[model samples]
Target chain A: MRLVISFIAGLVFSAGLVVSGMANPAKVVNFLDFSGSWDPSLAFVMIGAIAVASIGFRLVGENSKPFSAPRFDLPNRKDIDRPLISGAIFFGVGWGLSGYCPGPALVSLVLSSQAMLSLFPMMLLGMWIAKKTA
Target chain B: METLFTPWHSLFGGILIGSAAVLMLWGCGQILGVSGLLSRLLPPWSSSQDIKVRVAFVAGVIALPLLAMVSGQVSSIPPVNGNPLYLGLAGLVMGYGTVRGNGCTSGHGVCGISRLSQRSIVATLVFMATAAVTVYIARHLLGWI
Candidate 1:
């Protein structure tokens, strides 16, 4: 049942990505492109996502058990750590460069995007390195 | 690059994405962070892990788009900045950043901010500012794109 729910959620999430034009690299990069044809639609994506998720999250109690799972697995890190800042910097640079984040990058795979295909192996390597160093 | 300013469609899609996150949290008691999911799915598998759930979620993410494409709902796949070398570099940095940052656009930007997580909000701001600056450098200063 959990797996089924997860699968369905993934589908819904990807559906949103596709519908929002977020699955398009050009659209994403254009949003970042301030001096050259800037599109602020992605901002709406952020706002819309937050509004619904915030309301939904209100249902979960801080110490309450989940409906089907043992316990909530949310992050517990409280401080603004070094890794977070450095990582965001790197991720932002990458995002600005290619407009491919983890979610949309994976979604683009259904289309067999040549760019994503090429980047996949290297991305794995980077992740592996991060794990080792961490 | 062409700009797609479809606010309504973007909002609708975001709602769907948020609903998906809420579903995962409600059902599985997990934060739906795509990078975190991928990190677990890849190497050095842990003995006690919900590997199946991760696989199922990722499978669904891939499946819907494929189904849509097969059914002609999506007419075409837009080219994602055709330079493989550049994309490879960006992907490498992004992968590292996500794992290091402990979240991605979906995980940190959407779920974190909604939950009022300080780290997530700061991370989101940092990335947004950096991304905007990077774009400025690339499009305005460098004129690469």
Candidate 2:
């Protein structure tokens, strides 16, 4: 039962990436350009996700807890300290450079583009370094 | 329609993804985090029970679009190419990120933050920031543009 659900979720998530235009490197890069054609598609994607998640959150909260695990897994910190700022900066920088955030990037993989080819390796390297340092 | 990627459509898409995440989390008590299932491709990292859930999760994700296509909800796919290197790289980054941050954007950004998790907030911020920088360097500074 759970297996069926997971596969469906992944399919929906991946398909969303495709439908939202997040999987398009050109569109993604254009969004980051900010001065070129300035694609705001990613913003739409963000907004769409936030809206759905917000409503879904309320519904879920009202209903029984869904997963076998805890309802919510809260993080441990609250400060707007160095880690927070640095991480944000890093993430922004990466988005600007590669146009491949984690979600869309995975979706892009389904397409197999040159940009993804060049960018994904370094992205992994960055993640690796971060893990090691932490 | 202003094409699909317009603000309205994007917002609608995000809503769908978020709603899916929320529904899955609430109904199944799972986080709807993609990284967990993707990581299951590895033998040591995955458990027997985890495999079942992972399969279902991934299948569901795929099915939604196919169903939509069948029902004519969406007209066309985003696009596709035959570039294995690119696919491999994307996979690698996603896999590594999952390991490093203990979650991906879906895990931390959507699910964790929705739950008011401090760690998820931090992790989500990092994921976004890193992605931003990566784009800047590749397209603007690095001439991959």
Candidate 3:
């Protein structure tokens, strides 16, 4: 079923995050620190992920619909706008500050991490604010 | 402390993530984006179907990691900025920024670039640059996170 597949996908995705070292905030922050003792591990994560994903997109291009769904929900927006740039900058700053992006932060929840425990609620609040403003 | 660059694990992990994206696309006919999926769980969302996907996906995300930890496969304590206040600030900024930009690392950085979307490429560059600058300021200039 579709639900089973989603769960499996989630499991695989989380495993990747863990194995890639993206789940470690300290490691991520070190990767972001270009001027410092830079760890280029994170770059490989993107490189590896994109390389595989590109093939997936190619396969999808040949198909009209997904296997389990009626239609594919790929983003059609192409324009580079103000909000995009500004939002990205903010996101970047946040990423640099704590090295805890949403995905990894969520994974860290099982650890009962003090930082994520605080970050998660605030993140939801931020999302709520964004929704309200938009 | 000296930080080690782990190419093998990083690359392998990335491949797994990509595989998941591929499966999601092929099986679910949807982009496998963490923040995007998380956003759907919020208010004013579309329908129950959306809820099911998010719930099932997130449950798996959490469940596996939890199992992994029990097996001693996952354990990471943030070396810097363990302070809740600082993390909370970062979280708020990230949450808003990701929504405003319409994606994050998984959504735009990986999936978008994989599809070779111009918007995603630019957004990824901008975020990567800004993140580098932010780290420079916090670590080198300000001497703090």
Report the C-alpha lDDT of model 2 over A1-134, residue by residue, as the tens digit. Answer: 54555555677677667667775656766765553456777777766776677667777777555555435432455556554455555555444444455666555443543445655565556565555555
Q: For each candidate, report its DockQ versus the true two-chain complex.
A: 0.80, 0.33, 0.80
Cα lDDT for residue B124, model 3? 92
Give per-residue CA lDDT, model 2, range B103-126, as digits (tens): 665766677766667777777766
**What is the Cα-based lDDT of residue B113 in candidate 2?**
69
lDDT of 3 by residue, A1-134 (tens): 77888889999998999889888877888898877889999999999999999997898779888887778878999999998999899889888898877788788887546767889988877777777777
Alpha-carbon RMSD, each predicted model = 1.4, 5.1, 1.3
Show pairs that collide, candidate 1. none
iRMS per model, in Å, is: 1.2, 5.0, 1.2
Give a tens-digit lDDT track for model 1, residues A1-134. Answer: 89998999899999999998888877888888777788889888888899999999997655387777888888988999999999999889988887888888888887656777777777777777887788
DockQ of 3: 0.80
RMSD of 1: 1.4
